[model samples]
Target: MRITDLLKQDTAILDLQAQGKEAVIDELIAKLNEGGRLADSQAFREAIMLRESHSTTGLGDGVAIPRCS
Candidate 1:
């Protein structure tokens, strides 16, 4: 599917209320879980946290692309 397809209203956060990195991850993970996109939220959270520990996904200009596997 295309990126637009994945960025539907169910999974998109128009006005993020999170204030920090971890908080942002948590919020997004919650959204994903709510959309039935994650089998285990805890596991996904751990993986994402581990990935962030290595280096930030921020690409500057207020953009970030966080991913985990």
Candidate 2:
């Protein structure tokens, strides 16, 4: 299916009220969980946190692409 098809109204946070990196990640993960996107939210969170420990994912211009396995 197309990515647009997977997009949902409840999963979209128009106003991101997070300040820092971890907070943003937490907020996003919470949204994903609320929308029933993942099997284990805690595991996904730990994986992303571990990845962040290596280095920041900033690609410049106020952009960050955090990926998880």
Candidate 3:
């Protein structure tokens, strides 16, 4: 599925403060939870982590596409 499909308006952060990939992932999860997309913060965090493990979804040019099933 497209990343935009999974990206909630309230959860999609632009120019996040995190310094690394993991931190950026955590920030996304937090935003998703805050927006009530996931059941809880932990579940949201895990979902992003699992997706990243399979492949680097970064589409290059400083753009990253993250999706969860």
Task: Order candidates by lDDT, high to low.
Answer: 1, 2, 3
Worst 10 residues of 3 by lDDT: 1-10
lDDT by residue for model 3 over 1-69, one digit each (tens)? 455655666777876888678987777777766787667678766776898899987998777866666
RMSD of 1: 2.1
RMSD of 3: 2.4
RMSD, every candidate, angstroms: 2.1, 2.7, 2.4
Q: lDDT of candidate 1 vs native? A: 0.85
Q: Per-prediction TM-score, please?
A: 0.85, 0.77, 0.73
lDDT comparison, 2 vs 3, better candidate: 2
Instruction: Write one digit per residue (lDDT tens) for candidate 2, span 1-69.
Output: 344633689888779899899999898889989998878999989998998898887898867766564
Lowest lDDT 10-residue stretch of candidate 2: 1-10
Q: Which ten residues in a row have the lowest lDDT in candidate 1?
A: 1-10
- TM-score head-to-head 1 vs 3, winner: 1
Estimate the TM-score for candidate 3: 0.73
Q: Score residue 32 of candidate 1 by CA lDDT.
A: 84
Best of the candidates, lDDT? 1
What is the Cα-based lDDT of residue 55 in candidate 2? 83
lDDT against the true structure, each candidate: 0.85, 0.81, 0.74
